[model samples]
Target: MSLTLEQRLDTLPAGAEVAWCGQQYVTAGQLRADVATLAGWLAAHPARHWALCLDDAYAFTVALLACGMAGCVAVLPGHRRPAGLEEQAPYIEALLVDGDWSSAVLSFPVCHWQAVMAAPLSAAPTTPWPAPLSVLMFTSGSTGVPQAILKQERELLAEVEIQAGLWADALAGAVILATVSQQHIYGLLFRILLPLRLGLPLAAATCTTPEQLQAAVRGLMRPWALISSPAFLEHLDPDLSCPGARWLVSSGGPLSASGAALSQRCLGLSPVELYGSSETGGIAWRQQHGSDWMLLPGLTLSVDAAETWWLTSPFLPAGQRWALSDRLVWQENGFRLLGRADRVIKLAEKRISLDEVERRLRAVPWIAEAAVVPLEIGGRRCLGAVLIPSAEGWRLHATLGEGRLLLQLRQALRPWLEPVALPRRLRCLSAMPVNSQGKRPYAVLKELFDVAIEC
Candidate 1:
C-alpha cells in the first residue's frame, strides 16, 4: 500500500530529524511548524499564483509545501535572472525569494523569507493531502524559450511512492544527500520527495563541487544514499572516502559505461541511472552492468511505427499517453533507449537544443551567421559553433586578437544563454560552407570542427 503525503507526514515522529544544516539538525516538528506558519501567511494573502525563487534548499522546500497546502499554484523558473522573472511576472502574483535582489526593480512584488517567518502559525489548513494544487516547472531551455510542464500534487506523491517501493530495501534507514538542485524535476523527486515521504533525514545544502560533497559525508556514521547526476559522478575523486553510502543514483542524462565503472572503483558503488524526462516522470532505470533498462512498477510502454517510445504511467494524467522524444526498442522487462529523435542533445546532463544555440549565436551582434553542432570530446559531449563574422566582429578580431575577441563575445552572450548552451569550441568563418547546388553542406561544416577550423 502507498502512503499519501499527509499520512507520511503523520508517520514521522515530531523529534525525528528531517534535515541537517551544516552541523545542526532540524527536526520534523520544526519543519512542520514552519510549513504551517508559511501556509497561514499564504492563505491570508490569497494569491492565485506564486513564484518560488529561493536558493536555500530548506527554504525552497518549505515554500513549496506551504503553497500546496494553501492551494495556490507555484511557479518555479529555471533561471533567477531579472529578465527571466519578468517573463513569468504576468503569470505570477508575487515572487518568494531568499536571495538578495534589492537593487534591481521588478514588476511583481517580492516576498522575502524574513517576512514569511514572522507570520503567526495557524492550524494546518483543512486542505486534504495530495491536494489539487498545481506546480509549473520551467525547463532551462537549452534549445529555445523555457517550456512549462504542469504537475499535480498527486503526480508528485505517486512518483515518490513508486520510487520508495523500488528501492525499499536499499534505502531503508539511510540518510539522503544530493549534488543536484531541488529546482529540477529529478532533484525534486529524489532529493526532496523521496526522503520526506519515507521519513529520512535530508541535507540542507546541495553539494555543488566534489570537495563539498566529500566534506559533507566525511564523518557521518549513518548509512547514506546519494542522489546525483552523470556530470557530477563522472568527476568523483577515487581517493576520497565515501564510507557510509549504500548506493549512488544518477539521472538527468545517461551515465557512460566508463563513468559508471569509475564511480564504482572510486565510490565503491556503481551508479543506478534513471532514464526519464520532466514531461514523463520516470520511465525506466538501469545499473551500470545492465545493457537494458528495467521499467518501474505500474508503467506501460509502447512504440509507434516511427520507433518513438510512448508511455502511460500513474504519474501522467488519466487516459493521456505521452510520446517521448527518444527512440527505443522494447524488451520483455523494459526497453533499450537507442537515441533521441529530436535535435536536442544532452551536454553535461543538461538537455541542450542545437537549434536554440544557433539562434542565440545569430542574435549576437558580432555574429553575422551561426551554426551549432554537438561533438563528443574526451568521453563527453560538447557544442561546437561555426560563425560568419559581422563587420563589427571583424574589426574587434583584428584589433583585440582572436582569443580576446572570442572572450568578449562569449561574455556578452551569457545574459541571453546558459553556460551549457555557450559553445566551448568556436570558429569564425569567411562565409557559410556550401556545395555546388548552393545548399549548405552539413558534412563539411561538421568536419571543419573535427579538423582545424580557420578563424
Candidate 2:
C-alpha cells in the first residue's frame, strides 16, 4: 500500500522529486530541510496563529507544512492586499510572506519566508501532526462581511482521500499544474494537498496565462492534470494545443457549456466540474455541462420545506447538518442545482457578495445609495454599479466627468475589495428602480447597464 501524506513526509527517499520550481526540480530532501528549518523558526515564535500570503506555491506549501509541524493555526485570507490583511489582523498573530512587500503597510509582524528558508538546517525529526489541527479561512457571507470558517485537519484529509480514491488511477504518473491560487479551499486541496498525498509532483508557480500553461506542459513531456477554474478555462485559446494533459478539474463556479466544449477542443478532455463551498467541503461533481451532479462518497442531502439544501458529511464539523443557500432538484442518478437563493455570486471564480459590494460603495463619502448587479461583459462575468450619488458626488462628477468619477470610486473601493470584485461598469442614477413591492428587482438593476453610455 502507498504511504499516507504523513508517512511519506517522514519516509520518502531524499532524491525523490517533489515540486518543479523555476527551471529545476525541488527534491524531497530540500523540502524536508526547508520545512524543518521553518518549523523551528515558527516554533520559537510566540504567535499561535500565522497568516500565509505567499505567492509562490512552493513557498506556500513549505509555510503551510511548517505551521502544522510547529503547532500553529494557518489562516488563509484569500488575498494579499494590505487592507485585506489588516481586516484579518485580529485573528492572526503574524504574517508569512514570500515576495517583496516593502511598500505594504501592515499592523502585524511580518516573517520573511525566504530568509527563514535560508537559515541553517535543523535536525528535528518530522512527526505526525497532532490530532484536530485546524486552519482558518475567510469567505464572503450573505450579510456582507467576511465570515471565518474553521476547518480541521481530519476534514481536509478526508477530502483528499475521497478525491484520491476517485481519480488517482486516471492521474497516475501525471504531474499537476494549476491556474488557481492556493489561498482558496479548492486550490489548497487540488494543487497542494492532493498532489502531496498522492506523491505527484506539482508546479511551484501558477500558470496565469495560456502561454504559460502551454510552456509548462511542453517542458514536462509527461502526462499532466490541470487544476483550474471556470474563469481561466473560459479564456483559454481554442487553438492552443496541450498535448500531454490527461485530466482537467474546474471549480469555484459553474462552468458554461461553451467553456466546457472549448476545453474539450483545446485540452482534449472535458473538465470535471466540482460543486461545493468553503462552509461545506466538496459535495458533487460532473463532467458534462448541464448534467446532474453526482455526490461524492459518504454524503447525505436533505431539503427543507422552503427548498433550501442541507448537507451532512464526514468532512463537516462533527458530521452536523449544515444549511446551504443553494436549491437543488433530485434526479434519478443525482441532483441538479437550480440556483442560489442568496445575493452572492462568483466573479472570475472568486466568491463575491453583491451586498458586500453595495455596502462598500455606500460607505464611500460621495455615494448616497448604491446597488450592484452582475453583468456579462465580453464573454466574462463582472459587476456593474448603479449609484445615487450625494450632492457633492454629483458636483464632482460634473466637474471630473464620468471617467474620472468612476476611477475615484474604484480607487476608494480598492482597499476593501478584491480586484475581481470591483465593479467594471458604473452609472449614476437619480433614483433606484424599484417595484411596487418596494424591492429592487434584479432585472431592472441589470437593465441600467444596457445603455450605451455606461461609465
- The per-model lDDT (C-alpha) reads 0.78, 0.87
| Count of backbone clashes, every candidate in sequence | 2, 0
Model number with the top lDDT = 2
TM-score of each: 0.90, 0.95
263-344, model 2: which lDDT tens digit per residue?
9999999999999999898999999998899999999898878777889997898848989888788999899888888988
Q: What does candidate 1 score on TM?
A: 0.90
Model 1 CA lDDT for position 376 = 69
The parts of candidate 2 lying over 4 Å away from their true place are: 1-5, 121-132
Q: After superposition, how far is residue 127 of candidate 1 from its true place, in Å?
A: 5.8
Error of 2 at 1 (Å): 13
Model 1 C-alpha RMSD vs. true structure (Å) is: 2.9
Best by TM-score: 2
